[model samples]
Target: MTGRFAYGLRVHGLDRVTDLMPAPPGDDLPEVTIRQHTGPRPVPEPLDRWRQVRLLADGRHLAVDRRSGTATFHGPPLTPDLLAHPYLAAPAVVVNRWTGRETFHAGTFVRHGRAFAVLGSRTAGKSSLLAALAARDVPVLADDVAVVHDGGVFAGPRCIDLRQPVPGLALPGRTAREGSRTRVSLPPVATHVPLAGWIFLSWGPGPALARLPAADALGRLAAERSWPQLPSDPAVLLTLAALPAWELTRPREWGALEATCRLVESAAEAAAGQPA
Candidate 1:
């Protein structure tokens, strides 16, 4: 199977082809090709880790070694959104990492020519805040993951997600057109976002926001992905170092989301002032 998607690439020679980016401008080939391994799978190097999906990275290509399809994804009703999107999207992250890029579980939005990225674990108020920000017509650069390369931010898949829906708050999936669930969508971003800053979301009693030292921010980023030591480590560390970052503490109060957004906005403005 084969297809194309955003982010300059294609899906080539795979059994169960799903969503793909449109070829880069002029029908360029995919950044990496995927093929099923019917023979014996390659043994992992001493440091390699293979959980549900096996990720192999080398100078030639980023490979996804798998036996299951989207059907194997255990979840609620088998909606097209759950089936088609995640299968391709998740592997792409490891692929980017293999290519010496850093990917984050971030929801990124552009405002006034600058972009703000929110990063956190599940239910850390990242998605709830995404639900709120989308209400104000902020263009989301990426969701689920954001790829950082050459001082800019590129879209992952459009995922305006939350643990549970909040009343009176609308999100991406609600107004999705036919097939939107299965297909990937990003705002018409003709160019990458000049990433202004990243906000690390954490939960606690106090909602105070604070600046993160470069070293501390770098540590948090590496810790989140459990990034293994490899030749690619320097590039990943350099990418995180180039950006300004902050830790946005979510107040335990249920009503604090709005205030947190305000704080995030301020942090973004402060980031905009820095050199990219």
Candidate 2:
């Protein structure tokens, strides 16, 4: 069980192999150990205030003890895709939150050297847009969960799981079906990249990108956080909100995807030049 890195944490005890980033040279991120429950499903301690537990409808169980940096999973054997997603994803958020970091339900893409988080609701085509960006040689830090700490974004699993395959975009990697979505593995990225700005997805009759005020951006980010019930560090959220943000709206038609990608790239380039 070699330790693997993802979302700024060194993960240990995963039985199934997943496309996780390698531990960097002289890595010093906090560690979270994973283990399997063999006996009766272990019950969470009532007095453990930092404990977070979730039992999925599919019979999978996940429990994260933030104070001890341990995560336990129980259920059927996990595929790489499953291990990389809900199993690892949920616990990552909990551990980060307890360790003075913030987690968002957003996809992250990179242009030049900085990362931009794409925020939207579940059906907002985030993964699809990431797939499009990947096809154009843009770097994707994380496709589903973006973790932030110390004004930087941590790279997550090296894959994007799309609900449906994007038409005419052939991304090279191992492709497999993961439940209702198709998982496409991608090349690994650096452990961390400087946070740049944010892009919010929306629908409209025409494609447009409009800058958002700090207050509006903060509200949207608060709403799209990973664990709303958990306590968050207000200072970190406020700092992230102060970064540049924009609302990106486009038509729903597939033909608009190309133009939308162009808009995002252009906006990122323009924003990169301004003072932070």
Instruction: Report the lDDT tens digits of candidate 1 across residue range 59-176.
Output: 1112343222111222223334442344444556555555556666677888678777788886676666776776656677655666777677775444554445654654444422
Clashing pairs in 1: 4-20, 4-21, 4-22, 5-20, 5-21, 5-22, 6-21, 10-30
Question: What's the CA error at residue 196 for candidate 2, in Å?
Answer: 0.9
Total clashes in model 1, counting residue pairs 3 or more apart in sequence or in different chains: 8
* lDDT digits (tens) for residues 118-206 of candidate 2: 99998998989999999999999998899998888999988888877889798854545455777777788888999999999998876
Q: After superposition, how far is residue 261 of candidate 1 from its true place, in Å?
A: 1.2
How accurate locally is residue 186 in candidate 1, as Cα lDDT from 0 to 100?
39
Collision count of model 2? 0
Alpha-carbon local distance difference test for all models? 0.56, 0.83
What are the clash counts of all predictions, listed in order? 8, 0
The Cα error of candidate 1 at residue 80, in Å, is 4.5
- Model 2 has an lDDT value of 0.83
RMSD of each: 6.9, 2.6
